[model samples]
Target: MSQTRSSAVFGKRKEPHTIIIAHGDDIRHFTVRPWMAALCGSVLAAIAIGYLLATSYLVLRDDLIGATVARQARLQQAYEDRISALRTQVDRITSRQLLDQRLMESKVAELLDRQEELSERNGRMLPLLEKAAGASAGSADIPIPSAKPEVRADIAPANAYAASAVTNSAVAALARITKGSTAGKAGSASIADRADLMFLTINKSLREIESRQLEKIRTLTENAYKTADTIVAALESAGLEIDATYGSSDAGGPLVPVTGAESFDSEVEELDEALSKLDSVRDAATKMPIANPAPGRVVTSGFGVRRDPLIGKPAFHAGIDFRASIGLPVHATGTGTVSKAGWNGGYGRMVEIDHGDGLTTRFAHLSEIKVTEGQAIEVGQLLGLAGSSGRSTGPHIHYEIRRDDKPLNPVKFLKAGKAIGTLL
Candidate 1:
């Protein structure tokens, strides 16, 4: 009978009693197809998997973006720092270069100023130096002092002496007249005669004194003229164009017409001015490069302390010795005045040049003297022929440099040879 009742369950279940399995308040349907359940489970599983994947993807993307941003920021900062460092380095280099350039410019300007100052000084001193040289060369032409005419008390030498004799004769006549007269007459005559004689004697004596004073004045005037003439001659020899004039006067009792003390003071002032100019010239010359005596690269001796070749002892070698042929031409090291151009004790035929500023140069042991004393010479000009003169053992040029009477090494002055050659 239960089987017959179960037969209706296929299409419709008429019995109203519904059996429902419930989890909490939810009902469970058992009629669902297995394929549908399986499909639904699969859909839910796919949805869960998709949600998890999406969350993971978002998180990874955020991390990657943050890392990229951080890396970009670091790179930007590094680039900025590098730019700043490069800018700083560039600025420092530019500043240093500028400083060096300015320094060089300043040095050049200073040198130019010094050169100008020296040139002005040379212009002033050259004339005075020439005058001195000329005076030194021809001092024999000066005239000797002349003896003055003598004036005697009783007898006169010239017109004044004759006048004095006449005055004595008049005095004797007055004495005779007084002796011949009587007591009262003689007294009056003697008094008048004596007065007349006294006047004549006084006039004669005054005339003699005045004449002597005039002669002395004339002599002094002549002497002053001669001295001025000598000075003018010396100046001419020193290559100076000087206009000199002499004036004399025989007035004011035996007054000698002379170049006054004030004139001498003026000359001293001129000398001081010239000396100052010379100092400036010398300073300028020191800064400039000088020429060399020898042309070739061969140098036999150097300036400074060395073992003496002759004595084999330590000594201060003041000059540079250049080995050359006997007749080799020696040149002036700088522009200067030939101060001494003759033989010396140990230097043989030597030449000394004053190159301003107390700087002097000497060329010794010369076979020939090309330049004369007081001659103005230029650098690289032929001076003389080299020879084994003085205490030398071979044909060479003994060149010495001096400053303010003290010897200095010639090599130091010759260092400007290269630059000098280029300039020339």
Candidate 2:
């Protein structure tokens, strides 16, 4: 029977069951578990997350590297630009310094040239100064030393020294002129050498006393020039010829020489004699009248055309008449030698002065003549008394101005007198 049973038809096949293990307990349960599917899904998810994270990290790293490279490149470019700018500034400053140096050199050269020119000019002026000194001595009223002694002695050596000095100065000036543009140690040494030479030559002829005298002469000459300028200015103010007032013979005339070399030589000889005479004349004139003869008076008659005082008729008046009392003192116009002091035809009790330069003045119709012929009279000396001694109606002084024996307008001379008086 047992055999017939036949394995019980699958032998009660194990009930479709799952083993559940909970808390270490195993139990048979008719259920299905999906752990394998869930595990598979979890594995897939983990793989995806890992891929995303790797991609993000790689991208971030690449971006950072690119940014760093760009920043570095920009910084490098900025530094390069700054360096170029600084180089340009340095170049400009160097160029400016060079220009300034060149300008300074040019100015130095110009100054040296000017100094040389002045030295040459001074050399030319030395002879003139000596001549002026000689002339001044002769022009003085005091006696002067004779040149015979100095000339007879050996003055040639002094002349030679003077000539040598001048030559050396000229050479030094020329050297300075030539090398003024140079600016090195050699140039400096050359300049110093030239300066020393010039100093030595200048001091060779000039003693301490001579230097002082020269300085005084220079001051006096400057003062004389100023005086002459003042005189010219005053003449201009008075509407007179400036040259005429300055004692120019050919005032307002052309500078044409009369003759050729022969005439020029003769003229030169004549000029030398004239210059000697002029020195004496200047001395004499300095003692002549420089002020008014009569005070508190006015001119009643002017030189030139006027009606005759005795008769009402037109006549040429040769002199100006000043109204004054009979006892009024008549004064000399300038320092001079009295050429005539006596009664004349129309001018009773007259006084005449020879003031050189072909100029003369006459005071007529005086009460008494005080000066004698050939008497040296000083300026402002009493000459006579104003009176109507000649053909006059009243007491007055008749003054006359003559040049080369010809009568000129006394107005100009009188104005000159007034100017001189004011100055005094």
Native-to-model Cα distance after best TM-score fit, residue 356 in candidate 1, in Å: 0.8
Candidate 1 per-residue lDDT over residues 192-245, each given as its tens digit: 455455545545564454345344334333333444444334323423223333
Off by over 4 Å in 2: 1-222, 232-290, 422-424
Question: Ten residues in a row with the worst lDDT in model 2?
Answer: 147-156
Summarize candidate 2's per-residue lDDT along 192-245 as a digit string, tens digits: 556555545544444332333333333334333433444445444534333443
TM-score per candidate: 0.33, 0.39
Residue pairs with backbone overlap in model 2: 287-335, 288-334, 288-335, 288-379, 289-333, 289-334, 289-335, 289-379, 293-331
Error of 2 at 87 (Å): 57
